[model samples]
Target: MEALGTTSLGERSPWQDLPSELLGLVLQRVPSHAGRVRLRAVCRPWRDGARLQPPLPPLLPLLLQRDGTFLSLPDGTVHRIPVPDGVSCLMSTGTGSMLFLGHGDGRCSLLNPFCRDTTTPQYVDADCFGFQIPSGDPIVHNVRKVVIMSDHIITIQKTFEGYNCALSIRRRGQSTTTVDVRWMPHVAAYSFDAELFQEKLHIILSTHVGTIDLYVMDLIKDDNVSLQCILSTPVDNLFLPFGHIVDRYLVSSGDQLLLVKQDICKLYNKLMSAQFEVFEATDLSNGHAQWRKVDTLMGRALFLSAGCSMSLPASDRYAGAREDCIYFLCELGCYGIRKENLSFGIYDLRKGTLLSLPSETMVAQQGPQIASWLFPSNT
Candidate 1:
């Protein structure tokens, strides 16, 4: 038997030195955010061509903190994402693309996480004045929510004033998606809160009365989307309109359709008729028709946030404290709710378990509610 030749020289590369593409694939599966961060710093070619990749499919939901940062809960674990330049907004639409609106510009941009491809519609200006009036009068504020589905249907709703536009989602690498509004009268006073339920896109609108009008559109549907009346409020006098501008009119908590209405008359009489009814969506698939009155958060309340209970188990209760949970930029920020004085306050629903970051650390976050869809394990 011939003896195998032994090489005295230094050995060559093992595993035949993987291809550049294969090396990148192996590095990408490292599973650590830091590992990916390090991989980006390895080489310029790697960073640009291999490391900084587009987001994967089945986009994950993320919440943007007040500090202009995005938070993601991976497997119930929190992960902070680095913001790239030119990114004005970091709203995770749960559509595999984060919504980025330009600064002081009418154009809104959608960035794909997987492809790193961006689509910008310069003419697409969304009005966002919201559903809050300073003197408690409902007026048109030009605020609107525009949703673009994967299948290319755009549904928009103007806040408070009820202006709505249903336009065809413009094909990428194309020009105008605008319709000939000159021939038709514009529908005014349309309000909608959008969510993805049962693998379908559901836009919930409200009527003159408290009944909910659900527009169910399959992301894959090319036919005309239909609007169906789903549920009506139990109380006659109660109009489950959009909560104050601060409250998230968009399907509160990603699931429940929140309607915050108070009996101002009852507050004046100092009676207990101050009811903030919460209707739980029974079935979001069939056009949000089935609803049940859940519970009333008893008190003269203001804003709500999905937060953890600092002590005991961190429950997903609304975070601000009544005395200490002050709303910044509102009424001089002293009278709203102070985060420090919440320890022994009565009207505060924190139950002495409210978790708070330092007030100095927390700048003002806009909107009526602050929410985080942490992984189920985190909650």
Candidate 2:
């Protein structure tokens, strides 16, 4: 106890010697992942304490840039990662600094890029890479997004004319068990994306007839699963002029689920301008779920993309976070790598304005336009 307050006989007490119990309390109050990383940089004791206790809200995710490089987050430092040949990072999985790697031959692996000992953790054959799907249907699947949990991998697949969107759930060390719930919607309906929110998985399906349906799936005990319709809301008429396009994204934020709509206007596929509308669910659990518009997201910010969409606190500008912002991908033309074509920006919800990523980050490196946000798992 005295050591915490008093220095050594002839020298000052260093931060490296701070008690683990005391350090953990400080870590919990850290508002951003980058803040924790700075604390870990102090000394071995601080680093060990970070790994042992595991800070709050997990670590800030690394931005996987186009050219197989990693943007060191808030700082925006670029790192070239030599991923295994023929394998690509599918997304971030597990806990800390780990990634889900997809092999060219159709297999998956889990890797922690920070470590040298790389061992493939899990495997899903490319045969379907589709969660041990039964060999009966002959439809080419388009997976919207995959949520990888500790014990379960839930994939939300796209819908086709005759085939309904399928949610494939596969667990580890078990017989090929799957939660195969095929939702048959209108042939004209388009599946936007899926989100794992509030212990349940939900997929958004927007019909051409001006309606949005939220299909919520609950994975229950005894391997039982059930589907519920939470938000089946109608959209206002957007009697639009030519060259206007709208895309909706479903994101799970803090304690609420947000439905973000991106309105893009273009001429001859050239960039014009865009806007975002944010909405919150009123009666999320009740059968009659509804969405109400929210001008500000309190102090939280969102990162939106096709591969992954998530919400994180933006309370700490010192840790490189901005409040009430939506970071989105906007490739002017077909998703491409052309310097002039790669258009990305951060939309300030509070100000109702858009801001581009730093100019340095924009021209640093470019690869496949398909980039992903990764929150690593140490486990």
lDDT of each: 0.34, 0.61
The residue-by-residue lDDT of candidate 2 on 1-379, one tens digit each, is 2234335664545766778888887876664454566666766667777787853544345666656666655556666656777663345431224565655555656566766445544465643335221232212224445666656666655544343455566664443423333444543464456777776677787776678888787778736667777667777744656766666888888888899998777554322277899998778756667888999887888877666778878744344347888877643442223444544567898888777654335433355434556654441
lDDT of 1 by residue, 1-379 (tens): 0011122464433433335676555553543333455555554455555534444211122334433444432222334444345433333333323443332233445554433456553434332211122332222122233344454424342332233423223333334434312111133323345555545655555444444444555423443444444554433543434422212132333334444322212112121212233445666555546655544333222232222111111212323123322111111111122232111101223332223322323333432222222111111
Question: Residue 257, candidate 1: how far off, in angstroms?
Answer: 9.4
Highest TM-score scorer? 2
Total clashes in model 2, counting residue pairs 3 or more apart in sequence or in different chains? 8
RMSD of each: 12.4, 6.2
In candidate 2 the C-alpha lDDT for residue 355 amounts to: 73
In candidate 1, which residue ranges exceed 4 Å CA deviation?
Answer: 1-97, 102-105, 112-146, 153-155, 159-174, 180-191, 218-223, 234-280, 283-289, 293-354, 357-360, 363-379
Q: Which stretches of candidate 2 lie over 4 Å from their true place?
A: 1-42, 46-60, 92-98, 114-122, 131-141, 158-166, 173-188, 220-224, 237-241, 266-272, 331-340, 363-366, 376-379
Q: Assess the local accuracy of residue 48 in candidate 2 as a C-alpha lDDT between 0 and 100.
A: 74
